[model samples]
Target: MKRMIVRMTLPLLIVCLAFSSFSASARAASEEKYWDHWIERHAQPLDASNASNKDLRFLKKVLKGKRIVQLGETTHGAGEINATKVRMIKYLHEELGYDVLAFESGFPDTNASYLNMDQLTPKSTMKNSIYAVWHTEDVVELFDYMKEQKEKGDPLILTGFDIQSMKNSFNVAATQWVKAVDPEKAELLSQSENDFSTLVTDSNTFDEFSQKKEKLVKNYQKLIKFTKTHASELKENLPKEPKAYEMFMHSLQLRIDVMETYMLEEMKEKLEEYPENIEDFSFFMRDRMMAEQFQWVADTLYPKKKIIVWGHNYHLRKQNTKMIKDWVQLNGPNMGDYLPERLKKQTYTIGIYAYSGASLDSSDNKTVKPVTSPPPSGSLEALLKAADRPAVFVDFLHTKNKKGTSWMYTPRTALYWGYMEEQMILKEQYDGVIWLEHITPSVIIK
Candidate 1:
């Protein structure tokens, strides 16, 4: 009986091993074929040396008729990606007539940027308005180019859609609000400003800001009431500059809202013994604000003109299933996640990828360093690198070869904030992709 049982088990084990080997071989073959087909059919090689007329023509064909083109980078501080983005911006502007450069900086500060780009140098404008990481040579060059274009009768607008306005804008807006309506409240508002300013100045983190919870909420309520009371008069006074007035008020409101939102969350964290899900709440608030700003720019400000958006991939991706599911433990959405509902087919998101190279470690203040790890297997980056192209733009959303897109919805690697998440759905997240063979860090132009 023992001999018979052993003999049967050995045969069964052999059969199982054979099946496993066959399945592995089949999967490998299928993956290889997928890469080859995508490269052959959809990938458009880009010229690295110069913006050849042919290169511009190809990009125009890809971007033609798109009302909003969002360009995303794998990392925040990669110079090579920014350089490529600058190239794309020029092509989109000159050839495709994209008029607005919507950035991921502070909303209030962008007003400073647009007003000063013509009167000031790129460096000065950037330092005054844009984020620190964006103060690069390539960004400065972009500003200079935009300024030249505006001077030649083709006006280009510089705007931002983020909520991280610096302290100066907060003080200015509050002072204006007080002086305009109730001068008696000037001292009260100044005290609030000084309190907030002291917190920001004394510490790098939001600990102090969070500690002054009641003050933030009180200020926000005050501003909201003030805006409501003077809404009609303010709108009437700026007939020719209604958009400017709208933007100013919106910025002020958003700054207070964001600060108060954080402070509330901080209180909740401190109060709760076991905190409830705030991931969705926090993420939704920020992204929702950004989406509102973008909608304002596209629908309210420039309905007829195309806009070019620059930001990190996570912020720009149309779908954020993995992030929402993992972070919030629910199916919440993000900036691109919300925008598509309002903008529909007009929204086009392009995610940039790289096989391997160095990027600035934003976690540290460290400069250029190699990637933390190689592209994981079965990732979008791996598949793109397998295509054997140095530089290529693959339009997954509108590709004629639908077979190439079959693998897109699969969760893949997304490098964000000096870390990697290996579950981002490519096809759902972005409309297209720009794959670079190598990467380099952005230069700190101090």
Candidate 2:
């Protein structure tokens, strides 16, 4: 009788605790939603005074001196009404005394050998892989202003990845030319190899801008026509020496492809050196880009200078710190873990994120859901590790909501049914990161 009573009471006690915890989490989420409502409810522009003294104090702490402050937004802003962005910048420069202005459109760390972010120019106003031409307005506006400052002698130490066509061993200069006797005959395709060289060498000497543009068009046309003629003759002779002919053509076409068109690049050849699978590819690239960026910043930019960096919130997401994990554990003279001897621990990385995105909820990508009060700041695996009082709740509540599955119920039905793998990819390395979520996406799924 005594054993039976103890067994039954223990389960009842567990059910009660779970019920209370769920209720607390739900209430905390509701409070977050309410505060967010108050923050954005105002239509007034974000001004210096609109921010609190605490805001500036925090800014000062985060961005004092040559610290790198990276603000990652998925896309550029629109129109003149980007109040939030404008205010954010103002707080950094004015309150924090930040001297350098950096951009995520390019590299944020002061690494000269850093690989520049690729700038894709769309053929039209639409979007594509290589060029996000339409979204380029923000980059153009920001860089144009910076370039103007450089020209005025109030220069900034501007650094980022350049988006020039790497395929071109020679760029616009290869196609642009100097003047000939007249427009039509002068612009004619040059069959003379020396003429092509001369044109590219002295293209700047061409007075009229139109003259330079016309030369480029003619240069490509000439090459294309010449290739077509040669390829036809080779085809007729191909039955006897097809392999040799094909090899010759391949070499020739490659030249034109690089210096002329925006065709498929050498990603395949590069990929060939790595695992072909997507999981392997993503992890490999993530590590490679992260390492390359780190080496470029620390070694190339400043051997003995203090710096700051802003990157994707993902880089600093404490719970899901996948990007920097391998790098942190990396032990070497030039690894993320290895601080330079000259620098005695002034280096730090801070992550900032708005806890807003189409995350756990299946709704609009930009939809804002409530931020549940954080679970008692315990690792998800802690319950498995410590089994004194609380029973593990991995599958205890999966059937409570179809859209939002709690880790309680549905898990036991299937082996390894949790999103543990995806979640682990998110939590890895960081100093301290802030979680914020905006509540003003066009739709809210209550």
Candidate 3:
């Protein structure tokens, strides 16, 4: 009787153990099912080499009839990422007929230089048009490509939408605008030149402006009054034969207005103990200004033309992901948030991600290299690699009937400026993602 009981118990225990193992395997497969289906079945491999037209057909199909395509980078300066951007620009221009290439740069710094590209060599224009950090081999290649296109008489519209001007290009352009229209009132523009100069310094300029906030406000007011008073004359002086000058001035004034609004918001935030609201307000305003400028470019400057904007993933995302969601909860609705509202289905955004790479650290005057560590468990990067692909493009927006993707609502890892966020909402923030298994740092031009 004892031997029969033991034999029955041993068999039952073995059966139970087998069932437990199977259950665990099923759970593991379920955990990875969504990412696996997307990457393995749906995602396309992308070759970023300039000579490869292999992916162009796939890219064109994805971007078909889209008026505005905003392609974002994981970092500001990465060699493969920038090369990919340039390649996309070339493809979109040649295949899809995209003519405008909007950039994330100061308006007064890059616009006039690009518009007047004929007067300057590509090398000179690049050095003068953008900040020193962007002076890379990759960027130089892009500039040379633009110059070549311009020479072909199919000139691309190159413009910037940032406002970090070290030289007070706004003041220079503002003074020129007034001089062109109303020379007598041009002297009045110099009334705030000293204050502008104070804001123009390279060292701790934002801090300096905060200290003299009232003076900056007053200067903004003075410029506002001058422009409004001579609005008619300024409009009259605008050249009709070639409207680039008018476009440049209009953009300059718009940037000045945006900066003034930002400063005012910054001053108001000074009253709060935790001024997270200030940064949020600044971000919203800056993005709004960028969207406004792009709308102007689309409507007035080049009607019905397709445009592609290249910038950091944070700025280009359609939804405000974990990047801005700090202790301050209500941070965004960012630039990407505003742009898609206006463009609707016309806007298509692609965010780039790298699993591991070296990031550029330029915080100190000295440029150093920082190695990016691999993502933690259950992170987006980890899931992307589960597909066993070196590079992948997942079009979340275009894919239909995708199952079990609700997991994307949960946070995933995102890296920006040598900082990593472990809770970025990957799918909600972008229409698609371009994932690279490994990345290299952008070559800094001495």
Candidate topping lDDT: 1
Decide which is better by lDDT, 2 or 3. Answer: 3
lDDT of 3 at 161: 68
Give candidate 3's root-mean-square deviation (CA, Å).
9.7
Q: After superposition, how far is residue 69 of candidate 2 from its true place, in Å?
A: 3.2
TM-scores, one per candidate = 0.78, 0.37, 0.76
Residue 285 of model 2, lDDT score: 38
How far residue 105's Cα lies from its native spot in candidate 3, in Å, is 1.2
Worst 10-residue stretch by lDDT in candidate 3?
196-205
Pairwise TM-score winner, candidates 1 and 3: 1
Clashing residue pair totals per candidate (backbone < 3 A): 1, 25, 0
Q: For candidate 2, give the lDDT.
A: 0.32
List candidate 2 stretches off by more than 4 Å: 1-54, 63-66, 73-141, 144-154, 161-283, 302-310, 315-352, 355-446
- Best to worst by lDDT, what's the order? 1, 3, 2
Question: Whole-model lDDT for model 3 versus the true structure?
Answer: 0.67
Candidate 1 global TM-score: 0.78
- What is the per-residue lDDT of model 3 for residues 106-170, given as tens digits with 9 covering 90 to 100? 66667766755766777767776776666778888888889898889886778776755545444
Which residue runs of candidate 3 sit more than 4 Å off their true CA positions? 1-34, 168-197, 200-242, 267-280, 321-330, 362-371, 401-411
